[model samples]
Target: MDYLLTCDCGRKHTVSRKQADQLIECSCGQSLRVPTLRGLAKLPPATEGADSPPGDTAASTISKNGENPWSGWRGPCMAAACGGLIVSLAFASWYLLQRVSIDTSYTTEMEIAEGNKIFDLYTPEDMSLVWHSFESLGIGAKEPPLFIRWNRYAEDRARRASIAGGIAAACGIAAAGIWLSSRRRV
Candidate 1:
């Protein structure tokens, strides 16, 4: 059997069972007594709050393959990122749909406003001519027209939101794929 010895210089050395209790020169030039395996086993087990020897801790006890047992979070983090992106995309899509409806309604209102010459681009006498022109064009409507401006702001917002949604969707798909691949490897 092999006995483990820890030197005050923070070095660990393994000695034969027969050499237990014998003084041996450590690589750091210190003469240390080798600990017997039986005595080491007789030592009380470490508790959560108990003080550990130098160079040994609760983290060191659970290491495997030179890695901490709690170090694998890439897959979970990526999945969370993907979920967030999907939620953002859904909101963007809903906003885009709402903008489209607003744009259509605004456009129809602008057409009616043009038929009424609401911008004062013509004289009062020309307003009659404009109404005649609308009638000639088969757009006759007795409803008074409005002076509405195009909703360029909503249009621009919808455009930007669509682009953002598309990019987010792409990133979410890529993240999902990466997360799934990593899961398979684990």
Candidate 2:
């Protein structure tokens, strides 16, 4: 339930029982102290149509029913969605860095020619088998064939990560708009 607390400037504030004995700032810059629970009970209860003083946006957001608009699932859902957005963007950045690193690795003309020859000789399925075999034998990134394959794999993962990040960003924006609109309803 809410109670009406009158300020010295003649502005009335509809405050909740939880705000008992707390200091509340009035719109006129006056710091009014809410009465204690016993004193508060003696004051008049806020009517259903009681309006907060002008320019009090914080109070305006509270509905007549006394329930906070952002309460319950809305707050938690928004937090989780924002967290997902951050994680998605972080993964996208990491993948993009991996792609750039792989692309800039040193490769001589002779190595390129040898890599092209190996690439042309094997189908994708056969290349995967050969690459795995070479990988297991400790043929590292410096190898022409392995370097080419690793570069391609990194590029693919980067593209997928960026797409996921974009979707997450869109979702996060939409959720924020919805949450704000819900809060503004009074």
Each candidate: what lDDT?
Answer: 0.60, 0.75
Q: For model 1, name the residue pairs that clash.
A: none
Candidate 2 weakest ten by summed lDDT: 49-58
Q: What tens digits encode model 1's per-residue C-alpha lDDT throughout 45-131?
A: 433333222233332333333443334675466767788688778778877777766644646656767756764777878878877
In TM-score terms, candidate 1 sits at 0.37
What lDDT does candidate 2 reach at residue 13?
Answer: 85
Which candidate leads in TM-score? 2
**Candidate 1 residue-wise lDDT at 8:** 88
Judged by whole-model lDDT over C-alpha atoms, candidate 2 comes out at: 0.75
Position 169, candidate 2: lDDT: 86
- lDDT, candidate 1, at 158: 85
